[model samples]
Target: MLIFYYSKGSSALAAHILLEEAGANYEARHVALAQQEHMDPGYLAVNPKGRIPALETRDGFLSENPAILTYIAQTHPEAGMLPDTPYEAARVHAFNAYLSSTVHVAFAHFQKGARWTDDQAAIETMRAKVPVNLAEAAKLIEDHYFKGPWVMGDRYTIADPYLFLLHRWMEKAGTEFAPFEKLAAHVAAMRERSAVLRALEAHEIS
Candidate 1:
């Protein structure tokens, strides 16, 4: 598997963590977002959307961080990165939905050219909305969402890596994620995991 990702981006980080946790054999190719490498004709040919975190699997090229994580978990059940029960699986999926739809999209609004010329108004709007949405997401995760140490209870699932990735971004944005104590603790715990640590070190991110 070849993962085309941006080292500085959260989506790519999520995929990287999942790949490590799943103990999957893969190669990482960095697409420098700073240089608009994602939009290069060569990269665009692999992913029409010119997005990072695009995975080239034996089956085909897959995009989107959530889909890539799910594929890894499903393909490597021995890794136990996905819930076994149907309802548990649904909950994990819900967390991914919240991260992708709410958290990630809100962050995108602040990205270059995401809105009208990155105006001060547009940038501030995104900055304001992101904290509110992140706090809400943290609350939801703390209550009746994940079970134990990680998302999906005692067992660590793909959701944990995604959450960790997002939380790191939120911190960088000056969002006080401390409002959700459990969620914050959860992230810390995930960071302590050997697999997670290995992944971070491999990426030279932490």
Candidate 2:
């Protein structure tokens, strides 16, 4: 059995969604961020970095959203989490890269500024800078990234969960994502999925 340690509605939601989609033999354990359970000794033992979304597998603990999501998709090919062709696969990965690195970093600056610096003024400055950078990221996703109804067009892939998580984060960060019509449509489509709905419930997101 796979033991997934996650924080409610964190980036880990993508992995949880994938697991639900794949119908894998796994269990979800919530690490309450509000209580700082993620940094506790027991949780730290599972992930030395003290991060949520650590997956304990037979091989050991697998961390990082991209790696965990890719592993689940590959392991359960019948779930069709990834596309068939190599080019399409690359496209999916390309989207994931931008979301995880660029877009995610931009979103993090607002609330996670402490990770960057100890200075309160500097942190506030970073928080203030979020809207501008987030708007750019949103525009990028609206124009080139979201191909309409989905990240990769009509078909839902691993990228959907990854992208949808960003939508959630953007909303939580107080950004007006409705301006990105395509992305908003994608969010609507995502909400209808059984896996996505179940993931929301599993994490008590609603």
Candidate 3:
């Protein structure tokens, strides 16, 4: 598998960490979003949406980070990145949904623009709404399954890497994780994991 990504962003970071944690054999190809490489015709042909973190699998190309993560988890069930129980699987999906639909989109609108004509309004809206969504997501994580040092119970599942990446973005957004002690601790613990550390190092993140 080949993951085309930009290391500077959260989605790519999530995919990178997940691949590392799953012990998947994969190659990372850096797509320089800052240089607008994503807009090139070739890259756009690979992903018409012109997004980073596109996964090239034997079956086909997977674009969104959540889809790629789910595929990886499901493909390698022995890695224990996803839950076996139906309800637990739903909960994990819920977390990913909240991240994608809420936190991720919110940040995107704030950091990037929505429509050309609505950039200012979208930025202000995101600036106001993103914090609220992030806080709610963090609280839900703490209240629901923030046990045994992960988003899910004792197991270090796929959610940890995603949440960890989001936490780093939250810090950038000037939101303090202090309000969510459990989530904050989870981020710190995930940072210490050998796989996560190695992944970051391999990506030359920090």
Question: Which candidate has the top score in lDDT?
Answer: 2
lDDT for residue 64 in candidate 2, whole number 0-100: 80
Query: What would the per-residue lDDT of candidate 3 be over residues 1-206, giving only the tens digit for each residue?
Result: 65545545547888788888888888887788878988999888778999887888888888887888899898878888888899998888888877877778766654675543466765676676666666676777678756757777787777778788677667766667888888878877988888888878866767
Q: What residue pairs are clashing in model 2? A: none
Candidate lDDT scores, in order, read 0.77, 0.86, 0.76
Tens-digit per-residue lDDT, 73-182, candidate 1: 99899998887889888888888988888777766654543554547876677666766676666677688675767777678888888888767767766678777777
1-206 per-residue lDDT for model 2 (tens digits) = 99999988788899998999899999889899889999999998999898878999988888888888888999899988889999999989988888888888888888799999999999999888787777788898787777877788878788989988767777767777888887788888889999899999988887
By TM-score rank, best first, the candidates go: 2, 1, 3
As for model 1, its CA RMSD to the true structure in angstroms is 2.1
Local error of candidate 2 at residue 191 (angstroms): 0.7
lDDT of 1 at 146: 59
Report backbone clashes per prediction: 1, 0, 0
> Higher lDDT: candidate 1 or 2?
2
Q: What is the lDDT of residue 108 in candidate 2?
A: 87
Model 2, global lDDT: 0.86
Order of candidates by lDDT, top first?
Answer: 2, 1, 3
Candidate with the greatest TM-score versus the true structure: 2
- Checking candidate 3 for backbone clashes, the offending pairs are none
TM-scores for the candidates: 0.89, 0.94, 0.89
* Displacement of the residue 11 alpha carbon in candidate 3, Å: 1.6
